[model samples]
Each structure stands twice: as structure tokens, then as C-alpha cells.
Target: MTHGRQGGDGASDPESAGGGASDPEDPDAPTPSDAFGALGGETRLAVVRALDTESPRAFSDLAEATDADTTAGFAYHLRRLTERFVRQREDERYELTDAGRSVARAVAAGTYTASVDRDPVELDEPCPLCDGDGLVAAVADNVTEVGCGDCGGTVLRLSLPPGGYAARDSDEFADAVDAHHRRRIESFDDGVCPECTATVSARIEPAEDEADHGASHRDDEYVPVQTVYECETCGADLRCPVALTLLDHPAVVAFYHDHDRDVRDRPIWNVGSEWRERAVSRDPWCIVVSVRLDGEVLVCYVAGDGRVVDHRRESREEPSARADADDSATGTHTDDSTAVSTDDAETVRANDTAESGPAES
Candidate 1:
């Protein structure tokens, strides 16, 4: 998974995956433009396509697969792809390098050449915003959308890669989109960029205002606070509501566990009313995300930098039943929202979940 992002800076003798020490400013090394320029022709593409991608192939076998009129022509195209995209093995068989495999994967995924649109298909999940039962999933231009049919509010929006959507029906497409966002989000939560594995910086800010990362999701359809993550190295970024950051937090997971529900199984748009996030402070940026089930409430105090400063749970002596089969919650917080502090009151389970979920687009 290593790339050229390294080897250009730091260290007296940075090591190359090659047995020799890396040369930071090797004059003959291929430039980024040169690496891409080699793949511009049909002949070069034939060589890449012939690779199927990984098993090493003899030079004669590769030359036989391409439509090159002569072996010299095939050899010329192979030479252009060598070093950066294709590499020759010690056994004299040809294989793709990491960058070459990346191109093959992109080609197979249809990322650069595919477009898709699927009519709205009604989803069984309810809208978290309006609590409306008429929720639907739709795909257009390679992006999947889940919105409320009643309120016309968006529940989830994610740009899915073509391979994740093209062969799937609406239900499978929705599941694919949810799973994709969940992985990227989990990567972001771990303080790493999903694209390049760079250390990402994070902060919480007003949804309607742009943060330092040039992030602005300021439409009336969004929440009050939005969380932003940016990779200073790769300049990649991700945005979602502040509540999204707590989907895997220990207290929140335990609260859902106690109610006999798996929070991770719930769709990104059907997270229940307890997820209405708000920031009680902005100068120091402290966020309040509470998950309420029956008369039991779980409160998480989060800092602006996406850290959970503190958390506590308040429950009735005997809380009500778990959320119903229709995916709706029961029992609002009683007048005594702070009903417990003595022994049975602020009891939070110490369990933490490894899986995370998407709460926003």
C-alpha cells in the first residue's frame, strides 16, 4: 500500500522497498506527469488489460495477448508501462506494481467510465428527521440518497463507487452505500484519512458556517453542528453531523445494548430522535449528544476536537421495553431527566463496540 508520498523528504538514507537506499532526487526517476502519460494510448492499455491484474505472466504470453502487429511494437508498449505501472519479476514474468494495480482496480470499478440512475425504492427504515414511515432509497449519478417521503428531507447522501452500485438492486445498493460510508467514517474517527491513510485533523463547527477546512454543509436540511475532518497531507476531507462521531462510543453502544437493539444495524437515516445534537459551547466547542430509550438516558460530553470529554447514563429503577419492531422508540425522558445520581441512577455499562455506523451523509 506504500506510495511515492514518502522517499522525497527526511532521513539520511531512506529505504526503498527495493534492496537499495532511496534516492530523493534521482534525475532519471519518472515524474508524476510522465507516469500518467504512458497510459494514454490503446497499445499501453492493451498491455494493462492483458495483465488481468496479478498472476505473473511470461513476456511471450503478454505479447500474444495484445493486438500489437509485431513483437517489437508489443515490447515498446511494455517498456513504457515498466518501472511505475508494470514490473518484471526475477523469474522473467511480468506483474503490476501498486500504482498499476490501482489503475486496474479503477478500470474494473468503472469509476472513470460509468454513470448510474435508479428510481426511488421505498425503504423499510423510517426517517430520523420527521419520524415518517415513507422513507425511500434512490441512486443518481453514482450517488445513493435516502430521504423522507413526507418531509422531503434527506436522511443519507453518499457518492458510491460504480462497482458498489452498478450490479446491485435498490436494496443491495442502499446496503452497499451504508457499508461504504461506515468504513470511511470509521477511518475518520480513528484520526486517519480514508483515501491516503494520512493523519487527519478534526473540529466541530456550526453547520451553516465554513470551518478552516473550507467545509460548509449549510443548507436548512442539515443539523445545527457539523463535524469536519481534513488530511493535511493529502488534502482529503469528510463532513457529517456531530452526533455521527459518537456512533461507536462506549456509553452510547451500551445504552442501545441495554434496550435490546443493535445501533449498528439501524440505517444511517433512522437513528431515532435522541440523536438531535447541539453544542452547549462554541468558544471551547463542547457538544452534547444524548441517546434516550424509555426513561433511560445516555449523555456524552464531547470536545470540539471530536474527543468524548465525559459521559454518564441516567436510568429509572425499571425502564420500559426496548425499541419496537417498527423501528420506533418509546417513552420520552420523564420530567426528572436527572432522575438518578445516587446508586441506581448514573449507572453506565462499561461495554464498548468495535463496529461503527453512519449517522449522516
Candidate 2:
């Protein structure tokens, strides 16, 4: 009569028997029941199977798919599954919670790979704070009010997922991270005035004057060491140092921390070599830009504890601004004028209105 144990009849009620408690092969190990009592019933199993497939399904969809005896019946099972952390709902949609999905996928995959097996950076479970499904599609346009089917919760603003692409460990990985960081730093330079752009040049340089490091003066005085590039086009006379904004991205942090031995205690300390290699191994193309064109070019590094600073202006023309402009103009707009004739015109009108507020009446 226990919730999970079966009677001697050999054909016990599926509801009473523990469903996902443990591997049938290993009764003594930690079972799904120990984590949550979700794997405990037939109806709940059906509910989970339904969610595992196309998710963000409505309650009606679940009823239709599962052929539940009643909506109340479906709700009963869903509630129980929820109590066991098997599923979640967002607004009207129902989907597996992260824990639910993780388990569901494990069961589905037949052989679940342990977290240790993969690059430590590859895992991003549900939002620990809010257990919404971690998967989200990136939209070039603005997104609003996304719902998590598992938790039935609504997120008012949708954020782009952390750049999750990973770099494999190889000769090329270091080059890729360095290249990505360079592109991000160059992007910051492109946004500034020509003068600062020339000076910033999107590169980090050690202060030429040792006096700038405060070594000439008392050691107690803090002298700025890292230099960021600034955009001269923005009329900023002073350029700022490139900040490591990628650290804010959890995936990027994992790349460094997970591959700790490779980056730390290096024989020859080359940020370009060791850090870049480590960065790419976590997730390729994970750079985040956090530079602004203040009076002085201001850039914040985001790879670790985020920080801000100013850089010296070196010149007026940024090294790569022209190439970026050419790429923007030609790369994505091959047939711009022809393509904008019909639907694009309407979009242009809407955009103009959004930007200018009807020409100020």
C-alpha cells in the first residue's frame, strides 16, 4: 500500500509503483524519486512524454495529445509532475522544467553523458533563479513576452542567449579567440570619432611611459596599466582600453575556469596564446562588447570581475573602420534597392515613424 511499492499480485497499479525512482537494473542507487517523486504514475509519464515532444503546447494540446480522461485528469497529473519537478508551465504553454528536461533527455538519449565528460562550458541548465527552459532562439528584431511551457511563467523581455558556440582545443583555437576579441575591440573603435579611432586602434598596449604606471612615483599611488582603443569619430580626444566584456557571459567564464590548468601557471605568460586558447576552448565567438563613447572613450572589461577605464587617443582613423563600413554596406545588402521596393518600403516607413515620431507634427 506504499506509494511506490507493488503488491504480490505481480500486476500492480502503475500509479502505486514508483515509475522513475531508479534504474530497474540498480535498485540501490539514487533514483529519480529521491530527487523528486515525478516518476510515480502512468498519467504523469504520459504527461512527461507529451512535454518531451513539441513543447510550449497549450493545455488543450496536452489533452488532445495524451487523450486524457478529462482536463482535470490532465491537470491532476501535471500538478503531481510539477510537485516532483517533472514539468513547468509559462503562461499557457507547458514544457519540461530544466530538471525535468535534463532527466527526460537522459532517459530519451538512452545513455546520458555526465557533466564531466563534456567541455565544462557546454552546460547551461535552466535559469537557476527562474527554472525556464534554457533554450531560446535569437531574433534580429525585438522580442517581448516569451513563455516557458514547463513552468507556465512569462518573461517580459527576452535576452539573447550567451554566445554558446565552443572552440575545440587545437592550434587554431587561440587564434579564434584572439580574432574575436580583436573584432570586438575594433568594433568599439569604429563607434568613436576619427581621432580617437586612430588612437584607440582597438588594441591593448602597455603604457609606454613607466611614469604612467606610477613606478616612478610612490608604489601606493595606483597607475592605470591596461589601455583600450577609442573611436575618434565620436569626438572623444582620449581613447579607452578595451575591456573584456566576454567574462559576463557564463559560458565564457566556464571556458577559463574549467580549463584552469591550461591558463594558470603558464611558463611564458602570453595572454594572446594561453588566455585566447583557453577562451576559445570554452565557447568560440563568445565575445561581448561593452564600450561606450563618453567624453573619453569608456570601455568595460567583462571576462572576469568587470571594470572600466580610459585609453590614450593615438590617431583619427581606426585601422579597420573602412573595411567594416564596406562589409556593412555590401555584405548583407546585395540587392538592397530592389529588395526594398515592396514589403521593405512598409518596413522602412514603420522604422522612420518609430525613429522620428511623425516628423514632430
Candidate 3:
């Protein structure tokens, strides 16, 4: 009998018999590793960089641009990059794919450059901690950071694309950074990674010491808390303040808009501190937020699953004079301080929904 590895039925495995080579007609599925591996060689990386000019280059022109000593070597590397990072057109010219262009831009942006000192870009917003004109933005080691010069606390810091800072003025660049940060926070709050669209888990917790400045500033005595979103699939992490996260809610935006205030026009640090008092319960499992905007008081209850379970609005008015007098005479103030349980809160939400309409998420 011939000795061989076999299945339970004593038949030889077809994979073993064929030496496990994938079928060439299988459409050549490419993975993320394959894309990264395409840039492993310096010659291959130079080829990608040469194609970053936003125009296709002929094979001979590209080989010349990359300074290839041998055409055969260049062709071998180019073949490896095909269908993933680089693509050849019908006219026999080659161009970078979207992934290839992104990688090329990153390389051009010096994302791997060593950390160096850079001047800070002045911002229009004032530092909430110090009440000074010291808020500025800067980029170093591929990270964009904004902070107060006097307080020495970084208000925001994030990694960006290598070309993130090119061809933009200070104000415009600041706006772009802010927008990027806002979108990321909103995406994370919606239980998805903005970068990879992977499922994310989030929780509200006190900010780390580096990210918080409560101890040094008297006005910022209240310890700041952050809503952290971590992706289970991609391992991407984002941390934003609880107030900032809630500010993106439709109801919150409507409330601000009704009061003739545009929340988006204000800086996050300014708005976050103002609304921090509204966060009554910042429990990671369940959060209860109450905001008094103008003459209306809005109460929002967020469940552990990161959904707004109940939201209700009430006018900020006192009880009738007679009721107040009666309560005063009985040594009990007629205050709307009743503790709301989950069931009662849900009931109030239902009643509010039936009376008016459900608040937008």
C-alpha cells in the first residue's frame, strides 16, 4: 500500500495532491498584506512614487524614472504590484491605484520623518482653561495637535494622512482638522469605525491625566470625561468628550438651532465645557443627560447599547401659586426633583411622543 495522508474515508486530500496552489482563474483576490508587500522593495516603492504625478507613465519612462539598472528586475517588481497597488491601462501605460496613491502620498508627506520642531498655527478660538489667545495647532511626527500655549494641555491630537497639511492656510487647515475630528467622533458614536467601517464598542469614562487639565485650572475643576470607541475588528480607538458626542444628536442640534445658536460655529472646547453640566449621569453602562436650552428642559436617557432609549422635553415653568403656597406651608417645596426610574422614564417618553412627536436621534 502507498503511504499518504488521507481523509476519514481513506481518500487522498485533493489539496495535498495539488500542492495547495490557488487556481489562476480565481480572479486573483488581493489582500491588505498583498498591497503592503508590494512596496517592500525600494525599486517598487520608487515606481509607486514616480506614478504619484497624477498621470500614467509608459513602462520605459517609469523604469527610467525609478533608475532601474535592469529592465527585467523592474518588470518583476511591477508584476508583483499589479492588480493591487498599480494597474496597467489598455494603452500600455501604468498608474497607481487608489491604495497606491494613498501610500505614495503618505510617503511623500514624510509620515515616517523624524520628529522636528514646528511653529504653531494660531486659531480663532480662545483657550477655555486660560481664557487667552494661546490656542494653536501644529504637526509633528505625522500627528496633528491643537492645544493652548499657556496651559500646555493638548485639546486635540490625531494622526492624519501624510499630505494632510500641504496646500492649506492655517485657518483652513484648522477647519479641515476640526471637521475630520468631528466626523470621526460621529462615526464612532454610531458604532462604526470611520476608517474601516468595522463594528465598534464604546463607553464613557473619565479622561486620562494627559488629556485632562482639571487639576491645574480652577474654572475647569470638574473632571472631564471622554466617550471612548474601540473597534473590535480593526483595533482603531477614538476618545471624545461626552458633551461633544451628544452635541451631534439631531435633537440637540435642533434645540440649539431653535435658540438662534449654531453649535457648529463654535469650537468644541468652548461648547463642551458649557454643556458638561447637562450630563447628569456619565455611567459607562447607562447615561442620563439633561440640558436646559432657553425656556425648555430636555432630558435624554442613553442605554448601554449606545442608543437613546428615551428623550423628553418640558417647559421650565414653576407650579401654580396655590400649589406652591400649599407646599411651602407643608414645609415641602413643589420642585420637579422627582427621581425617574427606567419604566417611568419610558412612560414619560411615550407620553411625550404621543403628545408631540418623537425627538430625532
Candidate 4:
């Protein structure tokens, strides 16, 4: 788990080279080997779980909590965790640092210690593409998937830490998952990786129209293009219909609110006709997505970069459907869920994912 490094060249402090990561010679700078090495053994790990709070814990208490090879050996391990994961106060009491707290909670979240899945929970919503039945939500390998079994196509897929499902009650389970998952999507839309807070790059490309793929049953009914955001470091992948990037946009949210519907209450697949995108171009990328409510429409001009640059509203009976209008400057911007982006579309998939809490299930 790489962290925001806090080292500076303490040119005078024997341990520092005066510049942090910039100075490869800075011995005190945060490094993968050193950060992870601090928790390499059971003793060190136990120490992290023991001092899980900001309140200082005396050395004796930490040692007693994690009785190790020996008191001296335990003390040595504690020393190793000192700056990167632990902090020592003036009175010599110790506490977990910000990164340390994150580690503790993540462990509790079951990212490092658990694998989970659940039986399919039948959903009342129909498949957006095929209008098929048997649409259900299931978890496997820690990823939550919602799709139609009959067509064998996945409509939506996202990673969920073990706690994502295991911690919710049946009555509120689905809504909780929706809120959590949507937040992750919003994060990606903002050009930020929810997992590691890294800069996320974005682009637009043709969506997979494979008939055999999940939900591609409609010969011409498919998300024609998608916006993808990828973490530069941790490999978190988030892909969605270009319109989905506006899921939280003020205008979009207000549009749904005015219609007596809470858009956030349902998954993107369930939103059906309310949210949609059809590409306007591929080069430099542009997309026109319409949110239709009560025979009225709101057209958003999205650039390849995923930002909603312009918008207009019209009655469904209006003369021309803007779907055919070309908006050429759509900004350009992942396989977290399988929208099936292609080779020429600039797909970015990360083999390694960051810590698991709040990630796609």
C-alpha cells in the first residue's frame, strides 16, 4: 500500500538525505520495502491492530497485547513501525498514524483477511437492454454483479469489499450498496481514483456491441460509447456510459428530482430510459446523452473528457431529436465493470488493485 510520503531531507538528521522521494539517497523517505517491511511479521501486525486508536498506548500495553518472541523483540518491531505507521508522543505513549488507522480499518473491512459472496437476490427491475426477466444481483470473488442469467449478460459489475454485503441488513441492503457504489462512480467521474486518491485519466471510445455479451441482445441497443477512468498507480478501473459521468451533476440530479424519482435509488441499469448516451464522434470524442422524463428531454453535451459541457431541454414532441446532432468537442477520458471497451478505444486495465474497502465488489 503506497502512501502519501511524508519525508523531507533533514540534511542534519542522519537518517534523511534532505529531499524526500526526489532524492533517491534519502534513507528516511517512504519506500514500499520499508513501509511494508514494518508490518512484515505477526508481531508488527499485532502492534497495528492493538494500537488502532489515536489515543496513546503505553509501550507496556502494546507489548502485553501482542506478546511476541520476547519483550525486547516486540519493542524492536514497534520501533520499526514508528514513523510510517505509528506516532510517539512526548510522554512516550504510541498511537496509529493516519496510514496506520487506514490499515487497521481496512483489515477490519476484510480486504486483507477475507473473501465473500452471496446468493443471487432477485431484483424487480427488468434488464435495460433485453427487457428480460431473472435480473438478479449476486456477489462473487468480492465483485457485485447485476444482470440477467437468461441472456448471460452482465448489465453492471463493481467491486465491493467483503463488508459491502456482509455488513448490510436485508431491508436496506440494496439501497446501501447503491449509495456506496454510486459514490465510487462519482469519484471516478471527478477524475479521481476512489481507491488510492491518484489522478485518473479519462477518454471515450466505442462500447462493445457483442451480441453474445451480456445485455447486447438488442442488435443496435447498446451503450455505443463509454468514458473510462483509471488510477495511474493502483489500477482501479471504472467504466460507464458517457451519461453516467453526469449521474451526480447538479442538473441531472435536479432533473430526476423534479420527476418524483430519486435517480440515486436505482442502479444505472435500472434507470433505463431516464439516462442514456449515444456517441456523436470518436476522434477527440463527443457524446450526446438525453435524460427523458414525462415526455420532456434534457440533452447534455459531454466531451471525451467526461465533463458535461453544455445542455438544453425540450419536449419529447420537439421537431428534431438532438441524438443526431454532432457535438465534436466532447472531452476524452476501465474494466471495473464490463462495458467491454475495445482495442482502438484506449482501454486501461490494472492487474493490481489497491486496498479493497469501497472498491467494486
Q: In terms of TM-score, how similar is model 3 to the real structure?
A: 0.66
Better of 1 and 3 by lDDT: 1
The lDDT of model 3 is 0.63
Candidate 2 lDDT by residue in tens digits, 86-196: 544547677877767765665554432221111112112343225555412222221212334455543222211112122233233223333443444334434433322
| Each model's total of backbone clashes | 0, 49, 0, 23
Encode model 1's per-residue lDDT on 1-361: one tens digit a residue: 0012233354322222222423346967776567778898887777777786536899888887778899888888899899689999999999888888888888878888898898999988777777778889888888777888899887667788888876887668887777777777778888988887878888876766455435533221223677788765565567787777678777777778889988888666566665545554444555557677776777666666777756767564422222121123323332233222212211221111113332221
Which has the greatest lDDT?
1
TM-score of each prediction = 0.75, 0.23, 0.66, 0.75
Lowest lDDT block of 10, candidate 3: 276-285
Compared with the true structure, model 1 gives a TM-score of 0.75
lDDT of 2 at 8: 65
lDDT of 4: 0.64
**What's the lDDT of the predicted structure labeled candidate 2?**
0.36
Q: In model 1, which residue pairs have backbone atoms overlapping below 3 Å?
A: none
* Residue 355 lDDT, candidate 4, scale 0-100: 32
lDDT of 4 by residue, 225-269 (tens): 777776665556666767667778877778888888876766666
lDDT of 4 at 283: 48
lDDT of 1: 0.66
Q: For model 2, give the 10-residue run with minimal summed lDDT.
A: 277-286
Give candidate 1 misplaced runs (Cα > 4 Å). 1-29, 210-223, 316-361
